[model samples]
Target: MNTVKIGWIGLGKMGIPMSQHLVKAGYPLNVYNRSKDKEDAFKAQGIGSAASPAELIQHTDVVFVMVSDDKAIDDIFTGENGLLKPEVSGRVIINMSTVSPAISKEMAAKCIAQGNHYLDAPVSGSVKQAEDAALVIMVGGDATAFEQVKPILEKLGKLAMLVGDTGAGNTAKLAINTLLGIVAQGLAETVTLARQNGIDAEALTTLLNNSALGSPLIKIKGEAIVNNNFNAAFALKYIAKDLRLAKDMGADTPLAQTAYKTYQDAEAALGEEDIIAVIKHLG
Candidate 1:
C-alpha cells in the first residue's frame, strides 16, 4: 500500500469508479459526499467515510474532487464544514471537475493561501473511460505538486499531462469539448442528411467508420444513434455547458457559434439524456 493516504469527494458517475481504482491499487482510501447514501455505499464496501469535507481531510494526505459544476465546486471548498473550514496544510487537493477556469483559479489561490496545493485536473472521456481507468487527464498547477501525485493520477487515467499552471486544465477541457460539440453536431447532421435520402444509419455509420473520419467516438456514438440508445453516458446539458464556457472564452468561429446554438436549443428537452441524443432533435 502507498504511504500517502488518499481522500475523495463527490462520488458521482465519474468519481465512484475513479476512486475505486485507488482503493484497488491498495491505497488506504477515505471518502465524503454531500449525499449520505453515497458515503454509506462506500462504507458497505468496507471503506471508511467522513461526515464532512473537513473531516475527510483530517485523515488523508491528498484529496481528489470530481463533482458536477462551478457552483458545486464552490460549495465543496467554501461552504460551512468545507475542506477549507479547518486550517490544514501540506495536503494536495486535485479537482477533476469540469468547471470554469476562473473558479479553479479562485480555489487554487484559496488553497495556496492556506499552505495547501491545488491542481485543476479535469479529464476527457465519460463514464466508460472512467470505469476502465482509460481517461486522459489534463493537469494544471504547481509542477512539483503534479509530480508528487502523478503516480496516483496514473491509476485513474491512461494519460496525465501537466499542461500549464492553475486553470489551464479547465481551459484545455473547454477547448476539447468545443471540438467535441462540433463533432457531435456534425455526426448528427450527417446522419440526418443520410436518413432524409433514405439511407440506413447502420450502413452510413459502417462506411464512416471505415472511412478517413473513423474514430472511437464516431463508432460508439454511431452505434448509439443506430440503436437509438440515448442513455446518459455524457449528458447533453454538459456539452451545452462546455460549449457555452468555450464561447465565453471567445470561441466565435462559424462552426463554434452554430454548434453552440444547436446544442443549446437541443438541451431544453434532451438535457438529461446522452449527448448523442441531439440526433433525436434533428429528426
Candidate 2:
C-alpha cells in the first residue's frame, strides 16, 4: 500500500478525511481540488498537488474521486484537463461519489476504452465514520482492479465489498440510501409525534436507543433531533440528491419519494443543516 502512488480528487467533507487516511497510511499521495485553498492545504502537509485532473493522472497509479454529483464528475473528467484525455491511460480511477449508476456505467466504459480501469465504489457512512475510517464501501467493476485496491480501501473503511460489475456499487449505494432517507423521516416523525403527545422528547429518544429498533443511525440522529443540533454530518441536500437519483433510476420508491420531498422542503429552510434536521419539518 505504501508503494502505491495515490491521487485524490474532491476535498469536501468525506473526501478530506478519507484522503487524510490514505496519506497517513503512507501511500505516495497527490491531490487536486478546484478550490486552490484546499489543494494548497494538502500540499502544505507534504502531499503533491496537481493543477488539474490530467496532471494528477500523470503522477498517480490510482485516482480516487469523491465529488458531489454527475455534473461535477463530468466537469472534472471531460474537459481539456479531464481524466479521460488521451494522455491519461493505464491508471485506475475509483469513483466513490454517490451518483447515478447509469452515469457510472458510462464513465466506466469511457475509461476502459482509454485503457484505464474504473471502479464504482461508493461508501455508506457520514463524516464521523470517514474520520474514524469505519465506512462500508461497496465496489463494482473489474475483479482484478478491485483486488489491487482492496488493501488501500481497507485503510479508509471497515468493510469493502465488490457488489457486481460496473455501476453495481452505485446501485447498492442508492438502495442503502433509500433506506436511510425513509428511516430518517420515520424517526423524525416518531419523535415529533411523541413530543406532540406530551411525552418528553429526550426520554423517548433514550428509550428508542435502548430498544431493538435502535440502529447506530437512529441513536446518533435521534440525539441530534432531540437536542436540535443541526450541524451537518451529512447535508440534507445531498440526501435529497440521492433520493432523486434513486427515483430517476426507477426504484419504485414511494416511501423514498415522500422522504425526498420532505428533505427538499427541509433543504429550502435548512439546506446546509445535517440530514437529521429533516426533523425540523415535522409537526
Candidate 3:
C-alpha cells in the first residue's frame, strides 16, 4: 500500500462521505474545514483534524481540497495562512472543486512557483453517489502528480482519469455540467408543459424512458418533477454559479450566454433546490 498520508479540505455534503471512504480505506488523514462542526465526520472516522490550513499543510502528503469556488480555492492555496506558504515545498494539492479553467491555470502557476504540485480533479455524482464511492472523476495536472494521487483518488471515486493538464479538467467539467443543465431544464419544461396540456407527466416520463432522448439524466432526474422534493444533491446556487462561468465562456461562444440566461431564469423561478428542480422555472 502506498503510504501517502492524506489531507483534505472542505467537509460539505460531498466532502463528508468522501472523507469517510478515505479513513475507512485506512489512509492516515489530516482534514480541515472552516466550520468546526463540519469536521465531525473526519474525527468520527479517526482522521485527525487541523485547526487551520497551515496546520493541516504541516501534517500531510497530498492535500485534497473539495472547496467551494475560485475564491475559496485562492484563500486556501494562497492566503496568508494558505497551504502554499513560502516555506512549504514538495506537497501536492488536488482540487476537486469545479472552478473556472482560467483560475485552474493560475492555480497551477502558483503551485509550480511555490515548488508544489496542483491538480484540478473535479467530479460528477450526487451526494448519495459520493457516499457510495461511485463518482465519475476528471483530473488534469502534471502527469507525475496525478500518478501520485490516483490511488488516493480511487478511494473517493469509481471512475477516475487524468485528462489533459490543469485547466482542461475544469473545462471538461463545465462543458459536461452545462449540457446537463440544459437537458435537465428541458426535461423540467417538457413535462410541465405536457402536464398543462392535460398529459400525465408520469406517463410522458414512461414514454420518454423508451425514446431516443431517453437518457439516464432524465430517468434519474425526471423523478424530481414527479415528486416535488428538491433537496439538493447538486444545489441551485451552485448551478447558477456555473452558468455565470458559462457566461464567461459565452464571450467566445454565444450559446453559453443563452445557457447562462437559462440558469438565471431557472434560479429566479425556484429560489433554491436540487439543480434538477430548475425545471420548476419552466412554468
Candidate 2 Cα errors over 4 Å, as ranges: none
Tens-digit per-residue lDDT, 164-276, candidate 3: 98887888888888877777777888888899899987899889999998976788787776777788888887877877776676533555666567778777656468887
Estimate the TM-score for candidate 2.
Answer: 0.97
| CA lDDT, every model vs. true structure | 0.94, 0.90, 0.82
What TM-score should be assigned to candidate 1?
0.98
Cα deviation in Å at residue 154, candidate 3?
A: 1.8
| Least well predicted 10-residue stretch by lDDT in candidate 3 | 250-259
**Candidate 2: residue 238 lDDT (0-100):** 90
Per-residue CA lDDT of candidate 2, range 120-160, in tens?
A: 99999999999999999999999999999999999999999
- Indicate the residue-level lDDT of 202 in model 1: 97
Q: Give per-model CA RMSD.
A: 0.8, 1.2, 1.8
Error of 3 at 145 (Å): 1.2
Q: Residue by residue across 121-140, what tens digits does model 1's lDDT show?
A: 99999999999999999999
How many Å off is the CA of 129 in candidate 3?
2.0
Rank list by lDDT: 1, 2, 3
User: Looking at candidate 1, what is the lDDT of residue 209?
Assistant: 100
Q: How far does residue 276 in candidate 3 sit from its true spot (Å)?
A: 2.1
TM-scores, each model vs. reference:
0.98, 0.97, 0.93
Give residue 270's lDDT in candidate 3 (0 to 100): 62
